[model samples]
Target: MDVPGPERRLAAVLAADMVGFSRLMEADETGTLARLKTHRIELIDPAIAKNRGRIIKTTGDGMLVEFHSIVDAVLCATEVQHRMMRRNSDVSPARWIQFRIGINLGDVIVEGDDIFGDGVNVAARLETLAEPGGICVSSAVRDQLGERLDGVEFEDIGEQIVKNIARPIRVFRVRLQQDARSPPDKMADTVAQIGRKPSIAVLPLVNMSGDQEQEFFADGLTEDVITELSRFHDLLVISRNSSFVYKGKAVKVQEVARELGVDYLLEGSVRKVGDRIRVTVQLIDAESDRHIWAERYDRKLEDVFAIQDEITCAIVATMAGRVEAATHDRAKRKPTDNMAAYECVLAAKVLHHRSAREDNAQALRLLDRALALDPNYAHAHAWKGCVLGQTWVYNWCEDRDATFQQVAAELETALALDDNDSDVHRILAAVNLNREDHDKAAYHQERALALNPNYDLIVVQQGELLTWLGLPEEGIDWIKKAMRLNPYHPERFWNHLGRACYCAEKYAEAAEAFSRITRPDHTHHAFLAATFAQMGSAVAAAAHAAEVVKREPGFTVATYLATQHYKREIDRRRHEAGLLKAGLPA
Candidate 1:
């Protein structure tokens, strides 16, 4: 039996229950009830109401409250708990009334005036885990609050096995003392390292063209807008890796802002009809959940770059109150004037990201078409190198050497055409790293980071280079940062993290990272086997080892080692020993 047409929405669910309701009632029913009523009237109810919380229902001992904002929910809970502690100071410990609170941000099912779902259930379970006069929050609630709630501190209490919840929930305890601050987490540290500039993330634009094929166009437009916005060195624009994760998903701006650690967000849609395209963009102050500026552009498809320029300038002006003369000039530098070529590049990018043999082939064809249309298109040239490199890496091409040469030539041309292009530098860095040209890779990686500090591809490559440079711990951080930046990042990112962890001798962590990939190819299996072997899990090692040989019969430690670019002989030998212990061919 299912309820039809039931309303549902995302909310921060707060569940609170008295610590000793039964015992309190036994002590003095009338006195306890009166004191509870007074507390709610004077402190609890006012705090919830002030923070825009809707009290969905109230039991004799507890209440279920909903808040549109996670921040508000936590704020209300903390306020009530802090006030209760102060109010109970004069009372005997046995007579003091206390409520344990838990908060979770999740999607809830709404029926009449009540909400039902895992969101509410989890909050209730978390409430039971809270201390008598303290607050506990699910990771979702804590992440959504991320360094935003000043004077508040959250200590990660690790994962909790809550009843009725299949998966272990990561819970954080909100310290009753509001002014205490623990050391910032990695994500917070990364945001801080990026400087205190007005940060903004541009979400992928929705494709409203009534054609699924136009999705590439929408994504491309979004990327261009992000690139244009990134050119403003003064504005800390989040990379497409982080922002595009929200593509085709229903998300609240405040949640996105908190997760990305950005104060502002740019989001919109693209609708194309024939030769004309309509683009709608809005800049929002994520903290206030208010629109700062919005505009709709109806223009010929050829004028897409102009639209990007307008959007960039508008955002810069809105955020900084004025656009720098240099930034405004940079915004107008179009990638290419040829519309068909631009569209081809966009389509090719979508195909390239798919990372399949057929898709890579199709991407190459599109890139060729793009290059033919506009020979000087730097992005197209760089992307062609990327596709060719992928083909060579996967042995998709007939001649690996020839493909490698073409990749190098294309990247060189791209570099000559647009020395400032971040993709060009990013690709060059990757290419150099693959060939063991450490110094060249380092140069390009630095340049790429400078050009597009937040680009996920570049960020992850930094980790890759660091791993090869025998700095696996540092590499792991960059890879993880890239993963956070792009929650939907490519599966190969897991491979990168696993490799870094393995190099760092963190076998269990490496195994976990590698296991996150849904479809493990032969290479992934080989790494898993090696990781298991390192951890002395002989049975697990042998199983993954069998998988490796089953997928590639000629798999041998020698061949694999030859392909790997480990700067240190010790690291290289460690991988070799692991593979040997895993029963791979000598």
Candidate 2:
């Protein structure tokens, strides 16, 4: 049954299906079907229209769509997912549904409205490879949109063999991040807006020190430098863990940039001999294959730690001052749901970061979906706990004690499933710190750091905890290190550094650090007031004290003290004296 006069040409095909449709139906078949129908009518259909997608055909739980533009096809898929997230927010996790999307740009034989042949099959196969609530695109789809997706990163998961396909397909997992150092978006107006940030990855230094014993030293040096480089507020630096994935393997810098979503690369080597050390470092523009900066350092190893510090300061001082401007363009914003339990968690993360009561509510709703989608997803459970903890932290919970208990239970589930996930351990660390369980907090913090030392949040949190633990000097150094790791970090980082500085009796330094905050809230003003008071500056202290009360009229030093969880009695007393001296109610 072949039709005559059929046209054949290149087109983009998008294949998508609801993940776990059968299980959802089994749980509540009739309700599930009705909800899915509503979703199709309200969300999916409209998005397809806006993106210029043609409806080809639909299976009971899946669909095949055709698009003239490859970019349209991919955008439609992400738009649909974004819409699904919004719709699912109103429902419970058990009723929430997610889709896995795959896209391929290849030639297809068109007969009437139906398309056939290798291209369609490739997209279908790609769909099966996508993490639920995630999209997978073939190399063809990726190649069609080049620099336009500069801010959008695709994690190359490598080649995969699919059914009914003779050749393996290279798959990339899309992940979204905002980097200020990246070039402007070059794609047409179809992609989402992620921050136009340029990113760089620093690879592990080769231990050219000849002695196998020096390998660890070389590795440590690389990590230290990465930590130092992360301080600039505008630059984006990939974590050391990600950069080290290519350790001992030769990789093209440009290829690495495409995979890591970084525009530049930093590679180096280290060698140490008797009382002497030599280091070589190069900064590369990955896209152009050009060396931006390269230097060799030769120093007598009078003090190993001192030499390392000197090198770190020299490099960070050089790079921190060189941030470039970037702009918005078409960006395929990748999502974050865990690899297996991808959908609900991805939506949850977006909601969680919205910093509002309603957004947190939506986040809880989506996280529930994540757990329903994959109850075995440890991160879902952990994130659920964190959300509950947030309710208490923000004073939104009806019963703080009950919320804390629930947080503990959820973390227990997370630890049981995968204690190795740095986030799980970090959340536990945060919760323990809140409960004043210093031992538990320290234990969890160490575990998290061990899991991913390059994680900026964990690194900064470690400093925060250390400062409270009466090691202000050490905490000051550590937090400063974290700032280098994430140059454009959140404002809270400076607050933590200021707190440590104030606690360590560095009054002027504390005021300077607090002053760096662009938007000072009541807490920032309160900290500044305390620092100024410590330095005996009556006018400056009084001004900040007045601002704090103006911003939070009911705030009192005692109330704030009760909320703080400083580990050392001495530090707490020191802070209280400063605040009280600055006219805060005792």
lDDT of each: 0.81, 0.78
Candidate 2 lDDT over residue span 223-321, tens digit each: 887776564323578988898899988888889989999877888888887878898888887767877667788999787778777777656544443
**Candidate 2: 10-residue stretch with minimal lDDT:** 323-332
lDDT tens digits by residue: candidate 1, 193-236: 32144578889989999988668778877776677566543367
RMSD of 1: 24.8
Candidate 2's TM-score? 0.48
Deviating ranges (above 4 Å) for candidate 1: 1-228, 232-339
Quantify how close model 2 is to the true structure by its C-alpha RMSD in Å.
18.7
Best by lDDT: 1
Q: How many steric overlaps are in each model, in order?
A: 0, 19
lDDT of 2 at 569: 92
